[model samples]
Target: MRKVSTWEVLFVPLFFLLILYPILAILGNITLEGMVRTFNDPIFWDAVKNTLVTAFFAALLSVLMALGFAYFYIFHPGTIIYRIADFMNDLPIALPHTVAGLALLLAFGRNMFGFAGPTGLAFTLLAVVLAMFFVSYPLAARTIASSAEEIDREMISVARTLGDSPPQAYRRVVIPLLGEAIFSGFVLGFSRSISEFAAVIMFGGNVPGMTQVLASYVFTKVEEGEVSMAVTASAFCILISLLLVLFLRLEGKLHARSEKSA
Candidate 1:
């Protein structure tokens, strides 16, 4: 094996100390009694269901919107509209979560839409989904757009030459080529959504069995001085995050294999 560089030797442990150590610490705090309590708690299960369902919807919406963004970004790159949208799409990543939550609250709360039945979407499950989507959209859009940029432009040109309209060409050619990217984008968005706390709490409220998700549930536990329950919930979140990381790694390997075969 090649000798490890001095920089790697110095920084590798530092990286683990900064990153992995905290995760390990959280896991270390997990106790059997806490785990049993968390598992037995109906509220915990409700939060789990809410988290998964809202995250799934948020991620699905993010990926769908990202597909449109990627299409415009790849096919109509020079348009002023695309330029404006491209800049705006990254706003979420830079904005503080609290600010994003406040923005969502302002935009959708209190009869902003006439059909929202007077109270509008704020503090509902839909608000949870919207908050998650707001924060996660940038990740999904950027991931899809980056992958779309890598596709051969010639394929699209050939499809157009064969008399396929832009929409049809995108449907038949671009989307098929974007399968892995789309999946990756959705997974990335879902992972981000599941971990969102500040935004969800601000817009959706921390109502147990309603808008409460795992992140907010953990926060609630911490606030109520249930450190053990908080640790258990944090460990559970870490486990879910680990599974998502494994999925991304597996997807990367599969994509690499497919590319090699191609």
Candidate 2:
């Protein structure tokens, strides 16, 4: 029989108490009326819509970029392309994302393009997408790469031996193996996107209608001392993000169970 340790039981619950208590305390400060009012506001609805659109597009773009990166990283190892892909995938994690925002702003600034955005502004949806993509890409790419590492090279060679084209082999043979990991990456990237504030605000300029994502909305509310609005917006964003992360964790458990059964 296995014995339970005192430190293990005590320490685990203590750890959760430390983390979860603060969140619960903050949430308790929000009255039901505050939530109701925030939901009924047109500005809140606009923020929600913008947040969803931006997060969806950001996750989509990140996954697409991650797939291409993982492909080259797996199939074309020990080359310049592979090194660059590897570096790019890890660079964002190693550095502050504000650098990416700064670089984008400089590259696509008003003076460079002499162009205005949708609301006759310098910052646009494109800037938000790029910033979110730059920050969240590592999650998808690294997750996919880890899965790709588990795949056998001989399986790929077998597909080529059967006269499958390179793209066909990737589509049929490689991507199928990468399914759960890719899904996990998408969820993580989405979670990251919805919670992203600093980079988006820095480069995207957070115009209320055009580029104002939920995180930016929440930040603006907080900065303006609109506590009710900030709490409500933050609560909704946290709920959505928690759901995504929960889904990813559940998928991991299911995958583990299946593997154990196998």
Top candidate on TM-score is 1
TM-score, every prediction? 0.95, 0.88
**Each prediction's Cα lDDT score?**
0.93, 0.82
Per-residue alpha-carbon lDDT of candidate 2 for residues 28-142, written as tens digits (9 for 90 to 100): 7787877887888787788788778877889988888888987787677888988987887778787776777777677777656555643232368877877788798888888
Model 2 gets an lDDT of 0.82
Q: What digit string (tens of lDDT, one per residue) describes model 1 on residues 22-123?
A: 999998999999999988999999999999999999999999999999889877899998999899997888999999999988889884754685657888
What is the number of backbone collisions in each predicted candidate, taken in the order shown? 0, 0
TM-score of model 1 vs. true structure: 0.95
